[model samples]
Target chain A: MASIYIDNWHIVLAALAIFITGALSLLMQLGLAKSIFIAATRMIVQLALVTLVLAWVFEQDSVWVVLMLLLLMGGFATYEIRARQKLAFTGLWSLGLGGIPMVGVGIMVLTFTLTTVIGPEPWYAPRYAIPLFGMLLGNSLTAVALALDQITRGAKQRQGEVNDRLALGMSRTEAMLPIVRDAMATGLLPIINSMAAAGVVSIPGMMTGQILAGADPANAVRYQIMITFAIAGTTGITLLLATWLAVMRLTDNRHRLRLDRLRSQKYPA
Target chain B: MLIIKNLTILPINVERLELKGGVTALAAPSGAGKSRLFAAIADLVVNEGEVSLDDVNRNDIAATEWRKRVRYVSAEPSWWGNTAQDHLSDDEKTRQMAVRFGLTTELFERPIEQLSTGERQRFGLLRALVDEPRVLLLDEPTAALDQDTSLKIEAELVRLAGEGRIIFIISHSEAQIERIATRVVNIIGGKLREGKK
Candidate 1:
């Protein structure tokens, strides 16, 4: 067995913690100081446990473990998206609509085009699996949540016009399509901006890591491009799926908005 | 049967009201809770008392479903979308209803923003009436219209009520109320009193 010495990790982490605490203090009152301390402590403990498990995952990783990790990430992302927005989708089908296709596309891009390491053993190496899928899943979750929130608010604000369309025999989903399309464009704007600025202004995280680990800049750039393309496609697909699912739940079979169940407080403050 | 029991409302401040579904004309000072009372029954206002239909508690019924059966048309005709046709459709039935109300097919596709005040008022009321609600909650439905349009809408209200729909109207026009309201319930300082015809 080989010994690992990840030097200066603690020092960097401590500095990050101090910075985070300073920011939290600026946001909270003196009365909330204890609550902030408890929250920070919990975050630290959880991250530490995850780090230990990831270390083992890297050492003896197999493809099965990678698949499980991806599913876990997607499941947790789905739950987090629902919790933060306080809205549920049509059903589990919507979750899979957003999740499976996205993670699958991301895996294909990472495995075939991006990397050189080819082996059945350690195929699900934490260093690669976690960071790659994490970025894809995290972005998909955020984009879906934002689109759903915006679309729901837009529909409510324009309820009169929506009802008019309903009176004209447009189904609830058809009535909401314009609003959904507008929201989807808004949700994709950030990623588009990032892509536009990717090479000149900023290098993305994965590309930066590969460069730091002695991979050629050109190769890293190539990998980053592929990942970005994959992410853009997956994100668009996931957002569409999530928005469709969320909006479908807003109506009943009779084709009217189930307004009483709406989580109105979830609107942006 | 919009049964409002122990109905307390606060449009500006604390106010209380109680009413049952009928041709009730609400008359009050501008800042009083007449509109608030209407909104309470429509489930638009954040109210405390029970607003029930028949023996069924509205609190148990989904507000949206309950609202579908009891239409609340605001005086300020909410202009949504870009055009008139976008606001309301010109389907065969809607067109026939428009013709019945003396509206032209041109008004159907015109953007609501482009419609005249009277046209918008007519359109708003038509939007509500088209649903065939059991109870019609009007927040001064003709407040934005001219005298002629107001009279015409008043006629439409009389007709609608005559067809057995429960109409609750909030109005300042003594003439209109006298002409149309089967029973006028005056609310002065948030208290309800049946006005003598």
Candidate 2:
């Protein structure tokens, strides 16, 4: 049997589902039709653009091109991490604190997966490297963002308690440990729930996509399992490291609670 | 003695102030930078000055060490733990001080949310005194207490001063200051000025 292909008209035929949803939203007067349509349009455009770009990148088949794309993805992710926070750190720290962990975990886990597990020829093949790293980056990006946001907010809300501890001669680490722990818990909860729900509550997106694309079910399941482990490991380590970096940014060697480092109410949205 | 020279922290400036081993009452209107002065001396706020306790410069010691030795207690204390006992220092001195401040052993086991504002204030003081700090900076330390408890706390502050701990206290009650303070300082026109007791 040959792998089936989706023609452009076939894709437009699928567009009916989105139109139905938009119609239902409008019928209900839910005020969601506009946003739904906008989002749907954005997704279509973005994915189409990525398809074109990925086609070119794959044709080029150079490590330099792949690495540049990876850098671009990483840069966008770092900006997103900073943007999501209501009380993110003020300067380069807003990027560095979360970005460091994200980059670190993505490089380590993806490299391990490709080199040891997947082992596709050329190792850095855009085919595998791009998608794998995208999956890892997207997954860990949420974790790092959650941890950074939670830690900063926790520090601000718990300023009195932490300062009291510091006043009692507790080191900066001790003063910040509780908030850090709480943030890490908040960050890890999503990945934990996703992993728990992967097979039971839902067939995860990657596995479903692969199966729909005509890969053997057995092989797709293996890929899903490996990716799940990679995502989980990446998320946990990224959260821990991001919270650690946030705690450092929150306090200094003087053990003073540096609420000044926070951006006050300057959140964009 | 605690000595501050040429200290400037925002709206509050102190050219020179020397505090002996006694309770010095800091009095001013609301937002007069009275609390800011206390925070600066405790090294909790950013300030520019030379502060030394017995010739040991604030810069010479670690920030934690300085804060431990010179503790600052805020008026509205915070509780992160579920129970009051969790915030209380687990030590003989804290236990003894808790009882002396009229806190029952039962109060320790109760959830911190159940604590009254007055009760939390007392706990805040006890928390700072857990390790017997050399200097205590208190912001309205007894603002919530009744006349009876206020007098009792005043007596305790005097006694702590007798033990050679320099205490800086912020208060709005002139009567309370007259009753407890060894020396009085007022923040006037954004500057700490020595006032006649």
Candidate 3:
């Protein structure tokens, strides 16, 4: 069966749902009516822009355009990760450490999915590769950001305990292993929870989108499963890499904990 | 001997202080930067100075190695892991030192959170001593202890010093300083002044 076409009037009619929600929010005095209106407007504008860009990109049929878009997404993801952190390392280390890993891992996982699983022609086909890489990059960015923030804050809070261990002859890496482990676990928790609840408590966004677009239910479920696995892999690898790089930046070659490199408040008095 | 030359820790300056292998008690008023001085000597904070142990410059040694040789114990000790035993080395000598410090063997297995402040302080000292450091920079090692416990720790520190270990202690009690220190120096307004008991 062909998917039903949605005209401009249909879109406007569909938007009434958001207005209803905003009205309910206002009546309830939840203080979220304005935010809901703004967010809904921004979402429509952003998605429209993305649609125009993707249409142009798909028509161009150039691998360079696809690669450039991927790079742009990765760069923004990196900046977001750094921005979200309370205690981040300065200079290129902050950008490169998390940004490079997330993009690199995203590219690797996307390439594998495109070539081995989807097996689409030209492998760089904008439709499959771009969307898949976007999903991976987005998820990996969140994971890496969480991991970086957790580890940096954890190290700062535990500065005394860490230094105590260092003074007791433990190397910098050895002293920081526990914090790193804790941060990694925290970073992976969101993805793990989402995976656990998928299809049971809620239908995932990708699967819902595919089903809405008139894809076969079985095919959509399979694709969702693969995407979830790719996301899990991307998040795990990116978070681990980011955490290790962050830990390295926080310490020195002489096995000293150089918390001075971070841009956060000093340990409590 | 620990020779500190031209040591300019911000707000605390020691022109030239030569400490032989014995107890050198540092007596200073509250907020006189005594702890900063200890941290500087331990290389825990940024400072400009030359601290050499037997002609070996501190910068020449790796920080870990240097810290292993010259250990610093703060006024409030930090412990990791659930049990006190987790921080202590598993060896007969450490066990013996724990007993000598009046910490029973069972205390080692007890949860660190359950230990009293004085108990934690002694355990902190024991943890440092187990490393067999050449230099000990202690900040009010017995400030939380009772008179009897303080005397016991003082005796152990004296014995450790008699064994030729370089120890720099920060103590406010004049009686305690007199009882243990071979040389006493007062730090006032970031300047070191030699005082006679």
Candidate 4:
């Protein structure tokens, strides 16, 4: 591999950028000192842990190991999807509405990409699977979180309209059509914007990383394009499914606004 | 007859309520679950009970069907479209009703927010009436309108009720209740009790 390997000292040295920023934020009383310091430390710790775990899993190269890591990532993503929203479905709906669509879409897209597109040997190769699943899960869950937040908040804000429609005899889907459309837009916008801006606005992360690690620019660009398409497709389908489930939860079979399905969130991210 | 049996939808506990065709004015203090009752009878919210029209149970048909036959109009209407016309159908009957409510054809074309609250309330009722429900639960239908407009709307309601449709109205005005109600009920000690008409 024509990769430039960084020494331990390089990473330690790299962290100084965050240290300086954190110090300046503290000294200037910008009030972002604590958040900056914590977030920087958190990123470093998380990345370091990932590196160690990935290295071992790759060495072992077992399907179970890949699955364990996948589950771990999914668990974290579920926790994140929950924390990021201000309203939650009362009981099983929180998962039934939010978790299933995200994880389901993530796995299906990742599997398709692995087996067919990238076609990594064995189809479960940690080297290919873990990184790809990580990207898919990250993008899918962020879209899901945004969509659910928008949906739950929209249901509340448009309570009068929804109820009015329901009382006027609109079905659950019909009553929730406007809010669901709004949520689909909210969830899908970021990924769509990123896709729109990919090459011109900035070299995407994957392409940049690949070039820095000595992959050919043409190969990197092609891979970047594929990954972007995968992410966009995954996010769109996931949001569509999640938004439907959110509507099912926010309204009822009785064509009424089931505001009771939503609980005041005790947990905040 | 519209029948509510063993209904309990938080703060609204009615063992049973049966109404034959006439305007039955529901008079109660604010926050006494009058609106909640309207919601429960409409099968909205997390309500536990059985509501039936005549002998046809609400559960017998689809919820949309049930709501079409039994409409509930809120005091403040919500508008999704920019103008009143967006929601109202362009039918002769709807246009006639709009005119009866003192709402001009151009008024329906005006932006919903720009219209007065009284106009919005009237539009709310008119929108629901397009479906021509059998049982109407109007929660403070005339709360926002002036005396003259309120009387006109009340006359419309009474005329509708006279046509064998059951009307349940929650009105804050005792005078309005006495003027239009053929039967009157009051909320006393967390339960509904029939009073002088």
Query: Among these predicted structures, which one has the highest DockQ?
Result: 4
Residue B145 alpha-carbon offset, candidate 1, angstroms: 0.8
How many angstroms is the interface RMSD of candidate 4? 0.9
For candidate 2, lDDT tens digit of each residue in B1-197?
89999999878888999988888988788977777778888887678999999889999999988987888888888777898888766778778888788888888888888988888788877777767889999999899999887887888889889999999999889999899888998888877778989
Worst 10 residues of 4 chain A by lDDT: A248-257
Name the candidate that leads on lDDT. 3
Could you tell me the lDDT of residue B118 within candidate 4?
Answer: 89
lDDT of 2: 0.86
User: Relative to the true structure, how large is the alpha-carbon lDDT of every model?
Assistant: 0.69, 0.86, 0.88, 0.87
Listing every candidate in turn, what is its Cα RMSD in Å to the true structure after a full C-alpha superposition?
Answer: 8.9, 1.9, 2.8, 2.0
How big a share of the true inter-chain contacts is recovered in candidate 2? 0.62
Candidate 1 stretches greater than 4 Å from native: A1-120, A141-181, A192-226, A229-269, B11-22, B45-65, B100-102
Model 4: runs farther than 4 Å from truth? A22-38, B10-12
- The lDDT-based order of candidates, best leading, equals 3, 4, 2, 1
Per-residue CA lDDT of model 4 for B1-197, tens digit only, reads 89888998767678889999899999888999999889888887778898899899999999999888999888888989999999988899999888888888889899888999889889988998766799999999988999999988988988898888999999989899889899998888777899888
TM-scores for candidates 1 onward, in order? 0.60, 0.95, 0.93, 0.94
Q: What docking tier does model 1 reach?
A: incorrect
lDDT (Cα, tens digit) per residue for candidate 4, span A72-142: 88888988898888998888777667778888888888889988899878889998888878888898888
**What TM-score quantifies how close candidate 3 is to the native fold?**
0.93
Clashing pairs in 1: B83-B110, B83-B111, B83-B112, B84-B110, B84-B111, B84-B112, B85-B108, B85-B109, B85-B110
Residue-wise lDDT of candidate 3 within A1-269, one digit each (tens)?
66788899999899898889889988999999999889988998999999999999999999899999989888888888888788878777878989998999899989899999989888899999888888898788778878888888888899888878887777888889989999999889989999999999999998898898989999999999999999999999888888888888998776767788888523220
